[model samples]
Target: FEFIHPEFHEIVRRRLQTIIESRIVLPPVEQRLLRRDGSVVDVEVLALPFETEGGVTLQVTARDITQRRIAEAEREALEAALRQSQKLEAVGTLAGGIAHDFNNILSAIVGNTRLLLEDLSEAHPGWRSVKEIRSATHRARDLVKRLMAFSRQQESQRSAIPLAPLITEVQHMLRATIPAGIELTVRVPPDTPTILADATQIHQVLLNLCTNAWQAMPTNTGRIEISVTTLSEEAARAQSGTPLHGASHYVCIEVRDNGAGMSSETLEHIYEPFFTTKQPGEGSGLGLPVVHGIVQTHKGAIAVTSRPGEGTSFFVYLPACEAPPASFESAQRAVMRGTEQHVLYIDDEEPLVFLVQRTLERAGYRCTGEMNTARAIEIVRQAPDSFDLVITDLNMPGMSGLDVARELLMIRRDLPVVITTGYVRAPDVAAARDLGVRDVILKPDTIDELAMIVQKNLTGNR
Candidate 1:
């Protein structure tokens, strides 16, 4: 009785008394037992009342269940993590669909806007307004791209990027939005190594982390520090408590905030989708989850530490790579024009077909727009050498762009096929390449980009 934990002492006594009075065995109850050495162990206590020659004698058996309890707790945590992962994956699928549809609309707007701008002279009164509209479309395109990245629908275009310049760009962008009261500091050593990462996604990670840090300080007067440093593979493993593979060195980007921190309970769920501590209408609770997804996609790791009052710090570790050679900016040249090459473009969307036909014709190419895949294939089958290039949309009603490409190549082995899509999967891209696809271009291309692609493929084929 004295060895029982203080909180369970009374309950244990009551249960034992009940067992003795009833002269029967009671169900085992879980409780905690305190050792003389001041250590506590979880135990299951079973009390049985046995009638001997005298009165009822109570027999209590305590079994150590400390390890069992720990195992159960770990299993529950894993189940919870699995459920959260499934939920995020479902959300990502839905987000990808929405982004695909939204991108189609953006493509039309961007394409039309480019044509309108081309027709309007600089002296035109509506030119500035049209340019603003174009700018807004560009911003919208970037937003859609971010959504695609979050949904895991966009493939990363990685390059060896110097951390110093990237962080500086983020700092400059942050200064425009963060409150004046919040002190933002950035520190990157000149010798910091470069990291092989998608610059845009990495930028997004920093922006989200910094934004989250600033929001944590509701007082509006706090300090947020961003620092970059290099870590050895063993040091990274030790710091994060997780084994890292592949890269020998890692670049650690730490975002620390001196603000109201989070409790241990809150920390466990910070990465869960739609989990936020912000007030109503203040946040969508997606920043951290997106940050988590992006970092994981980059083959990086995030380690966070926080306490109720001692602020929080997020350490992001990305594999470092060798410094890339110096890059030079190329001079802007005029849009490449086609040499009246016969081109056949197919899409389910009639408006997109018309837009492409007109856009290509204006670029000195003879264009034929067909909305039906079957009809387009028939036209090519009838005259294989009539068209020099075939441009098709990826996600059509019946036969996809890859199917069309395969069929066209069967008829004309030397035909160049270009696939355009609002959204594409990695498998589809690989399949297209296997079918000898000239290029796979994403939707909402500018007038110049479309022209250049057409001309480049035509020239390559010739």
Candidate 2:
């Protein structure tokens, strides 16, 4: 009861005032009573009135009901939590469905745009516009990926990633989003060990944290700092309020901001879904929750601290790996040239199939496109050696790309096949690999990527 409310004088005065003003007999009512030692307890009161010699007298009976009240409160809390869980589950289902359809649409746009860029030289008048379109579609694809992530439908490709370079890349991108007045700093030691995690998901986690820090400073005039450090078991355990278990090495990424901090009440519910401090249209309150999900998926933990008028700091800790970080490079490679090799491409999406055919043909390959899986299987069955390679979309009506690949492999056991998909799941990839799939290509792949895969598989370089 002390935890509920330490003082009850005002509450008692208010109830007495209401009862006196009515001057009518009332049934039992719930009230708070302060015991002799100053602890508060819940009580049920029944007041009885009788006529005296000169005035009316009232007698009251107080029944202690603290246990019952506590039980009721707990039941109500559980009910509220259940309701919130159901609501969020529904939202996730809707978002995932929308993302699947949206990704397919984006794939078509991305594929066609890349094909257009292939035919038009840099000196062409429409080159810049086409490039811009492709860039926009890439951004759209990223947004879809985030939605899939929040819905727990997107596949994460985990690898050994260096923190310094990844943080540097994100820092450069964030400079444009934050205001000029805000000072942003990043400090990642070169010797920091690599972590096995999804690079894109890590990028999302970092970006979302920084974005929240930016929003926390409504004036857009504050300092934000991002730092990475390797933590020993003792140091890591000290940093988290929750128990740290079974991890010897951890990499800590800290984002600190000197802005308006959160109140105690606000901090308590910060990670609750749909709980937001921003005005309407300013935030969806899903940012922190998404960050939480991503970190957990990577076998990591996150913690936050804040005080009103002070600042806020978010700490993310991921298990570290001894392996050297993988290097990321972007350079123009020679376009893969294919011999007059016959390739069979199957996709339910006609636009994507047509775009892929045009792109492959330009790369000097003889290509055939099939929108129907049964027809594609017939072609493969009729002439097992007709096509040198098979490329099929993973998701389709009636027969999946994996099913087609299997049927094709049955006709010609050594036939190489690639799986293309707009959406991917870890289990799906594992299953495809088990089926002897040579490679899996994510949708909206550049013409260069398609050509390279086709050439590589045809040349027996899987």
Candidate 3:
């Protein structure tokens, strides 16, 4: 210990004694020290140092590590992100494979049974068995579809939808159901650009958030705000903890609630499926996870911020889509359009071909049916000008629907093909569109419904 200022050791000792009596360490000192050359050198000396019972002096050890700390922090953040991405990838891959196999099985059962029921009349004694089979198959089919969507395996029906309309619809529906004590508000921009998402999934996400908010505020006079606005890249990154988006354009919607908020621990685990805080039989715990999946399916990101007793907010950022082509440019309404066009329909399921032929005939279109893809292609090649449209099941044995459509197109470049399936993946749709298929119809569609789309696209009715 050195003298204080120009003072002697006695004064410094007195001050040190006082500080030590008060059980406080001496504050760090930043001063120059005399070097061997009699020149002052930059040094941070801890003066008035204390000593331990064993007589080891208490002095501060100074080291410059600001830059080191920053580099380490950055490395850690990157590693964390890589780990998360890997986990998601693994889960998504496994889920997709399982969902695909599950879907194929479902398709076989449901597709074949549907074809069978078409030939069985209501008066048939075994009709009751068929109906039961259909009912069970549908329930199982829906579950598989959900799994596929969650796993990002099922093809999304992407269309430019006005966010304002969807948000307004959801808010209006919610306001009618939510209690008066819990104020519900939707603030959407008048000119919010349309986003491409499945309409049903969007609706479900909104409903799930509203329901969760309602439960959180069972009795209180709480407030819930649903706001939609364009987000800057920085804002989106700040909320989502990633720079995965750009500042060019985005649509951000947040559901904010003034109710019992979740703890940090709960928030961290909220997106994990089946991890619920509700009592047994009270909550399914899939609501938020499904919401997470739906937003992800849209190539969007979601973030939740909460503080116990303060409130909670869930932010969803979706990329903005350009305005849709005008209504005049859209295919004409199938409900109003009449089709007299002849179609060559091919499906491995015999009953499906029969049902489709009957359906199209009833709708004024002449349909030629073939249960084999090879024979169907041969028939079309034999009479290239006979059929106006070709409708085929995308997956058929020996040759895929793509192969048949490609073969038909080679014979008749103007031929239009429509693909029907219980589930369509991204690649399947891409291949179909690449082949210039007129439309992709999800399976289990009514005959009249099928006729409408076929007529609209094939005849350019719109």
The weakest ten consecutive residues by lDDT in model 1 span 325-334
Candidate 2: worst 10 consecutive residues by lDDT?
326-335
RMSD of each: 6.0, 5.6, 12.6
TM-score of each prediction: 0.77, 0.73, 0.52
Query: Could you tell which candidate, 2 or 3, scores higher by lDDT?
Result: 2
Candidate 1 segments exceeding 4 Å error: 159-197, 215-220, 225-256, 260-332, 446-448
How displaced is residue 153 in candidate 2, in Å? Answer: 0.5
Judging by lDDT against the true structure, name the best candidate: 1
**lDDT to native, each model:** 0.84, 0.80, 0.71
lDDT of the structure predicted as candidate 2: 0.80
CA shift of 301, model 3, Å:
2.9
Structural RMSD, model 2: 5.6
Model 1: colliding residue pairs: none
State which candidate has the highest TM-score. 1
Give one digit per residue, the lDDT tens place, for model 3 in 172-250: 7788888888888889878777877776577778888878887788575799999998866676767688565533567
Per-residue error (Å), model 2, residue 254? 3.0
Ordered list by lDDT, greatest first: 1, 2, 3
